[model samples]
Target chain A: MNKSLSMLENHPHIWRAREQSQQEERFSLGFDQLDEALNGGISTSGVIRIRTLTGIGELSLFKHVISKQRTHKMIAFVNPPGDIQAPWLATFGIDVKQVLIVKPSTEKESLWATEQCLKSTACHCVILWSNGVNTKESRRLQVAATHNDALCLLFTRPNRNSMHNSAALQTLPISLDLCLNYRQHALEVSVLKQRHGWPKDSIAIHNDWTPNNRAIKWAVEHNKVKRHVLHSVS
Target chain B: MLWAYLYFHQITLDTHEKASLSVGNNSRYDTKNEARHKRTGESANGQHQPGKTQTPAVIVYCEKTNHIVQRNNGALQQGIEIGHGLAQAGALCPQVCIIPFSEEDERLTLVQLAHRLYPFVSDIVIDTHNTLAIRLDNLVHYYGGHKELWSTITHELNLSKVSYHFATAWSIEAARILALNGVDNYECDRDNIKHRLSQCSLSLTALDKKTKEALTRVGIRHVHQLLAMPVHELGRRFDNNTISYLTALRGETFPHVTLFRPAEHFEHFTLLPFDVENTQHLTPFMEKLLGYLAHYLRARNLQTSTLCFQIDFREHPSTQLEIKSALPQSTVDSWLSLLTLRIENEVLPEPAVSITLRCDNFETIEGSNGDFFSNRFNEVAQKQLIGRLNAKLGEECTFQPKVSDTHQFETMSNAEISSSISASTFTSDIVPTFLFDTPKPLTQSTKVCFGPVRLHSEWWHETPRKRDYFIAQTLYGVRMLIFKDEDNQWWAQGLFS
Candidate 1:
């Protein structure tokens, strides 16, 4: 207490509180372990960049987050206009009207739209899907996303080697990896990184609204990927 | 060429039951019954003191209905109600078709057919509104006079089963009267127009009077009588409107007819069913749209100086970016390249569903000569590379100072990474350019520890951050987080960039 007082006296301005309080407007990510892994939840701080190999659930994760935020705020999808697989997002609760999709006529338009979404305070989240995001552009969006207090997510299908080679990459204080658990009729999610506390192990989520009996039976039969549960315990 | 006229053609079908059922109402028949009950004339006619033994005048009005003279086994003459008498027509023939006569479509068709016959005539105004205004003055000479022109028009109209009464006169109104009442279809002319008018009627009914008393009072009737009236007296009695009407009838004022031609706006676009994920897929389609837009622009001698790019995402919404240029060029290649550079670094978190290009900042190209030689090959290539770097690094990792005269550090804003950077490159002023990344929080000795920089944005508004900023070092001497407080207190913001 005396040391704290001394530090405060020297500074004359810094808070001496035990907990550094931040704004609380977090959303449930559906997966409890993923939420726990992301320090409470993905930081609504700024733009969040998610890099993945093709067909690695980047788009699915984005759809999931958008579904969660769309109830209270507007979510935008900036891409080239195309037929969105409506059935895929139905289980996650995203419908046609709630999603505002933009397909820019030009590449410049795509970037400009992303910038606009980040600046839009009314927008809860902005998702930009493109095959061509580079380091400098991602950083710029991150700054804009942070300033607006709107979540900006970038989807990139970066190879493992390219991900490692991206010099501008900084460890995301929060990250989650969603994988298709073959044995179970659900996705197995694990936290790849966390800033605060270690996230609990991989949790096997059964098919949407799957009964507990089926989930338990599947888990008992295929427990090989259940090492995440053990890691959380230790 | 003919009289200036307004013509309306209405076609009515006997669909009382069918129409009512189609509207989903079964009570329409009852409503019709109620309407008939409220109509007082038919029921009250005999009750009114038996009209004091007064006999209602047998009104002999030929109520005209459908006017098409159709051929039944090549027969030319047609009647209004062949199957039923006038009194029982509605009940006996409940579904008879009523087609109001149209002079416009007839005249238009005649003029079109005439144009083909008289190819020397550069233009023909189809007086479709009036039935009697077919011109023979110019065409007569082409066909060697009255007989040939009349035969041609008659034969053409007859082939289409269209019965027409033809007349010739110095004025269109005279021709109209002659066509309606003449014995010979083509014998009426300038000399007989006055004689025909005088013989027709001397009552106001001839001038289209609707009331019986008014028709009787206008004893000074006939078109000739009305036309021969003193201009001043006509004006004082009937107002100035009659002067203009008489003037049009006497051919004193000529009406200029405008040929119908489609107006062109010079704009076009292409649409796709799905968002273009691959630039390769979008490039060719964009080229086609731009090609059409360019052709339209060139045809109008105009150019687009600014263009906008818009993309709609599958999951969320749309995004738009505008690109402004100092020059205008019709080529789509440059635009595609520039746009590709901008989007080259952008990652869409969702698949794009659609894209659109909007062009604005239009201006006249000034001359027919087109000369464009400001090749931006190197600049475009550099921009593409920089965009890739920036997208990966974060948009903040690149900055071009948006210079302003302000003492506060935060107020010193920077322009975004775009073409605007090169515009300000010529100036020699000390423009402080900052890195795109956030400045890392620095750790130092704290006589005055990291502070909450008391930044009251404006006193009048909900002022943000009465921050007191600080820089504090760790015990191990490693530089660390910078902090700011609300009321001149401390909290970490970021690390030094």
Candidate 2:
């Protein structure tokens, strides 16, 4: 019985329902409802695909998660849709030294750079803003992310002239596929697919989550006051 | 100090041999040369007679003396001697390639060899263009002993594939003289060196011809005979220079060299044994050049951000290709990948006879005494990733973004108009991460989530701008940074992405 227990403990492929533990460390989404719906939260490593139109609260949805990944210093931006301003990244508590911007001349180079950044140990988060990625390229990126134990986020904008079909997106070797949309004062997030899990219906996050907005400051103040009250009572 | 000296007997001839031997294997586009080859009664396929291909056709001729100063093994086997003229070389080996001896070229080859041995022996002096003297007293301990140090030196020299004669002695002069005269031995004991030094002819010493002849007249032919004479008598008979020379050779006085300090920057020039035209034919030479650079950087514990390659052709103007990196990089594989990519895009105007690698800036990193094979990512791996990207895409394509000091935003993301106004005009707080290159016309019916804030450019600007910016959301909840220009027209500035 002890030998079998040791084997179960050592093997990464085996999952235990009683322990409520994951194969890899999971990062909380900072929302109670969202965390429950997604089983625990986002994974610590592996590829995550986000499909949405530009200019919504797409990046803001993950801004909290990016700052949470403090294990490795670098956060690469490969072929971002636009210039990711230094002050903006700083506003989100990202150090200027941690930002590596790569503007590849071609789509192939963009894919290559994404893979290279995912494999580099100095980088904890690699955000690639690609028009689209094929199944083969996504598989390579996933492997690189797993080897370095870092998060690789592939951001794609769905539009009229989309290159790949829904079939290609379905077969991508990714841990999660989340679609984001911004509605008045809320973000509509729906889990399209997740590893070893079921798809979830869309949920409107009623809280204001826009970066550089008043809600973030309000939340900070609220947390400070709550901490002070608890300390005074103790 | 115990010193080891190396004499490159014929570096020029050896290099020439290696070049010719490699380029002769398969050349397909030489019909014009074939006509000339027929006139010279040679094979059209570049193949030599069964036994005649033993060495590269090499001869270094001195125009001043009208004689062959050096010859390769092929020329030696063909019975050409040192005093042979062009006519004699032609008669001995009809296919022998004769090149005029150049003092500058020979000196460059010597300096290149010295660079290879710099890491092994720190205190070294380029005694002459063709000879080097290295102080091994300090390095002997690091390498375990004199034998091990000598083995390391010989190992590096053998990699260069040059004909060299080396010896170790109590003094630099003795070692140099012994090496130049082909007294090849590794017994570095002081007594053994002195015994060998005693047998060298007086003519092998650096003494002036007038002094050597004068000493010969007195029957002092060998070193031992010269040493047997009284110093006072010798000083009385010889000039001050001769006595100092004797004192230095005897180890009583030391000669100081400028010390071959590996230069702050790297500059290595390689002359091909044969002119090469195709890109495929040049990778080997480039690899060898980069190998030398890698060794050079490792010895000095240096990293370079930018390095250039200069290619010289026979008639066309030479061109240079410069490869730059965002971070200081030092490694053979990293630089080779970048150089090969750059060479792929470059078009050679003419066949290149020589190539020179030059680096102007070097950063000396600290605490570099680490593992040679560790692959953990750090500054090295980061630089490698950036370097590969820059080489394939372009240099400016990869960079760390920095905010402009002016703080004024651009109408478009990439096309930032630098001549902007003060930072005080844009402090309203709600800004977006992504901006359009040019303001797009607002086609969507939007709801204003924030108030209109007035914005203006510097008054001194040629086209001063006045606008009202607002944070707005469209019907689909896609938030945008929009503005109203002086024309009362609405435009979308950027995305909240």
Candidate 3:
């Protein structure tokens, strides 16, 4: 063996990449492609931001992440915009008993709830839907997440090009930010900000709805054929 | 063998003071004036009589007999006596102020005294009327000795300014007899109890009035004279009850003293020093009350799930506010935080003069030793956070999702955020995670991706219905559950991740 290869073989633990050093400490996002893109999966510390347009399948991504979390740990949704369809989440293999929904009426209360869930070791993952969060609140949430080793995912709607102010866009934290949108009936995930390591510009994931749609089309065509045969016999 | 009895000498007077003490710097006379002001809607400033100010002279009038029942030191110095007619007492002490006696006030004061002494002794028996008999055998050594224990008891009583007479003996009966008859302090030894009883008056023993009169007729003026007679003859002469009382007092027989047990619930009331017109003034008082409650809980190894506060106003009916915890809590800080959050939104309807705190739903904490590891610490912190949030926001706003067994889409799941829900009993792989509150109509151009599961109702309703359910995909690539009715119209039921 080469001299450096022999040295590396002697102490493999010390020579591994820093990102892969604590592999067990991180939770997989359930997508091997996304995991490889982010240098192993999401770290079970600090905060991750996912910016997307309204009604662009943010909830579906959240359900996928929630299903990947450990069954024993609780998953909290702080101030979600709409009613959470429990049956739909159950279909994605998420345990309903371990899910907590906090609907805070005000923006201030929503931020507080997010921070509390992040600081609590009882919860394994927190999905926060916040419209406009400032820099200070984001920092507080990041510290809390680090304290408990909890995965915090903040999903926000992209700033609309309406009359005037861009305060929400300007205040985005300089951390890992991913932009998700629909492209040709598939999800297009792109990395807009990366604090460390190399990240690919974009990736396309075929929607999981393809097989279900094909089955539905076959059923509909079969039903139409049976109806036509009955009509001809009459 | 060390036993102590506390006799509240003038419980009626103390009860009167208790009601007025919270009004701040107001004497018993001012309390009467305030009561009069409440009834007539008149201010107390003009109701005061001249020269009656600060004269220690005070009178307690009994309405049933229309006579003076009690008098203060100033009245005593002026030669006022009990059982005198109200007219005569008023004439004798012109500067004296009179207040009516209330039985309710006296009863509440005695209960408060019992609560105060419970920490020092566990086996306390409240004697007839205004006496509390405490068994201080093993407890005396805890305070150094009998003398030190007595001093400690007196110190506490003096701090509360309770007018009390103390007595101790080998038996509870002897101590009560000594304290009732103006023998201020005495510690009778077991060997010399007979000698001690010999000096006590015959009227002080627990004998009926008829038996006492019969003994008096026979010229028995003291306990020794009654003891000189033959036992059989005494029993035949005055009845078995008198003989039994004599035997119990002399330490020859054990008396059946009904031991007092404090109620299992916690109830503490205090008259505020000043009227609480706003909720902010109540913080200190609430903290003090919570501290006492925490002490009680620690001693009993119990935690409370619910607590209620009753605030009494001078003119309005008392208002009640209840606070509930997500879990049984014993720590003072957790309870204080919840209480502070609850009081922030409360608006006081009237100025509160007194407050009462009570809790009955107490649960015994599982482990006596709170040696919690990191995991248990986190669990407690999470519970505290949930409790605070529920208290600040409404209970309905926070919950965990509960899955139910049902074929209907929306009915399959509901929020089960309350602690009362049992652990998950059932799980289904077929149920979708999200179901719309109401099904939406689907457009004709929508594409079906899966499912032609035909479902028919068993005619349970007035109309039997058939439907074909299908998994469909919107143009936006959202997976949805759509169903076609018997009329061939389709509706979007739910979405799948």
Candidate 4:
């Protein structure tokens, strides 16, 4: 057998293995601890589900991901819970002009709009608010988000007490599932599901209120004294 | 200095017929008769109605005198002649249709023709009469040669079924003279301009009737005979105006005509062969007009921010639809897509007889510097998305979110997005990504994370607010911006990651 012919035969086999590994590559979430726990930040080809209570910093975390990425593509918000406050988003270093908000009137429309935005080359990240979306729609969105090298972040309320497993917990389709809850003045993020990695214990990120904290403390003390005097007079 | 003059013969009559053809298969004679009956309140009696016997007929009207000016072959056979009054023509040939002349439609038709020819030639001069003289020297090579260019022009005219007389010469004045004198097709070369123009009759010159009669009395029947006279003697006899006219006619001097400058705004209208009942049928026409508009914009290096479509109905008044873009666009495909979206959403009130597309809002595009990795493609893609979304949903729906400088959560505004956000205005602040419309009351179990910021203002309100804001964490492991009012009521205002 000729040495060159044998090497050529092995070339395609090597290329196929490399291509398979490339498909499994992940995108860093810009948090080293979170990335370490998830093996990578999240797979670039699958959906990331964050199940939490309504007012926790889920949107802020998504904004963190967007601001950290170097891409210039737009970030789309589909069926947000309320009117997106531009000033609030700007405070997080997320460009307000680069954000596109779609307020769909119905659940079907919300799903459609999200799918369209996810597939469009115009959007690099699509943040969807999924409250009552069915499992079928979630699977469809997961496929669309993974079709290109864009990120799809799904935020939903936690189904903590459901007897049947929720879509967020069912890891058949999603690449990563995170459960975020606030505890003891900190944000606690725990990996509930990972495609090819072990789940790590919850990581606590301490909240920093700074500069404003002193003013709030002073105001609280001042208000307490005023309330005491008013109560005594009454 | 090669110039081409196009004369639309019987423009008024042709426009009327074309308008009739657009509305339906009914002839212009029938529509005019019907209109006349409606105005005069004359019932369609057997004797009052023309064409009752199904015979070929013609009717010409004089606008100034409101009478018949000329008769066609059919009416001539029936003893109707020039200068016959409307009633007199009708009595003479009871079967001939007499319709009033519409000078407005004629003028509009001429303008439409000029717009169609503007792309081929830049220097177009429309005379008081229905003649359009265009400088064709620059365009001959583009169309392969003089013959090819003339053939292309004639082909377009034939497609529109327009009756025109075409003549070319070294000067616009000579071309206009030859075209107005019923020259269907003629071109004068540089060396033959004098000899060819000399053969033209004196009636074709720009001289007044009195001057023409005086020349004829002096036995000067041909332009060559007039040119034979000494220039000084001719000027002494007929004044300097005639001498200058002859100079221009002989191609010795350029014609002193007002050079036609296209309007800053664009308007192109076409009469449809049949009434369009649905918008889908108008796609081809709309696409062609958009192509013309794109060419016009590209020629001037301009782009339009807005476009309007006016749909003229056969019976009812026309309706107008306006389409706007988020950014200046000169691409035909972008405009066509937007137009398609709008047309799909629109329902016509009546069948359309004609359509006029107009755009007035234009902007000059600044040339972008080319780079190996420029963000131009991304910017274009983003604009395309905005255009599509706005076309489908509506304007003001797709917007960029910006932070407002206010302490109240509800008062934070989301302004409509334009082309781009100013980079200098983006500053980092300590605010959450999602702010609730109305803050939610928090339970006592919610733990305080970090905040105790005090925001107290709006004293002018009926109930001034005094609140202490906090960065709190809920049991669900989410960070929130919580505030407590003076009443000691705690509410969650926004979310943090």
In order, candidate lDDTs are: 0.45, 0.75, 0.70, 0.70
Native interface contact recovery, all models: 0.00, 0.52, 0.43, 0.60
Q: Tell me the TM-score of each prediction against the true structure.
A: 0.30, 0.50, 0.44, 0.47
- Which one wins on DockQ? 4
True contacts kept of 2: 0.52
lDDT of 2 at B495: 73
Over B1-497, each residue of candidate 1 has an lDDT whose tens digit, in order, gives: 33211111110111112222332433543343233221213443323233333221111112464223221211111223333333443232222222222343334434333433333333334455433244456566677867666676566545433334555555555455555554344553555555655555433222444332342466654566666777786666553545665665566766454443222333222223233455544555555556656655665667776777666665777777566666676667666666677666666655554455667566776544434322212334334533553565456433323433332334433343433322221221111111213443334443322332334455555755454443333332211234454443443332110
> Over the stretch A143-232, how does candidate 4's per-residue lDDT look in tens digits?
888785677887887877763756445554666778887776677788887666667667876544222356667788887753455448
* Candidates sorted on DockQ, descending: 4, 2, 3, 1
Better of 1 and 3 by TM-score: 3
Q: What is the C-alpha RMSD of each candidate to the true structure, in Å?
A: 29.0, 21.5, 20.5, 19.4
Q: Which scores better on TM-score, 2 or 3?
A: 2
Task: Rank candidates by TM-score, best first.
Answer: 2, 4, 3, 1
DockQ of each: 0.01, 0.23, 0.21, 0.28
* lDDT tens digits by residue: candidate 2, B196-266: 88999888899999999998998889998987788899988889998987887888876667889876678
The lDDT, on a scale of 0 to 1, for candidate 2 is 0.75
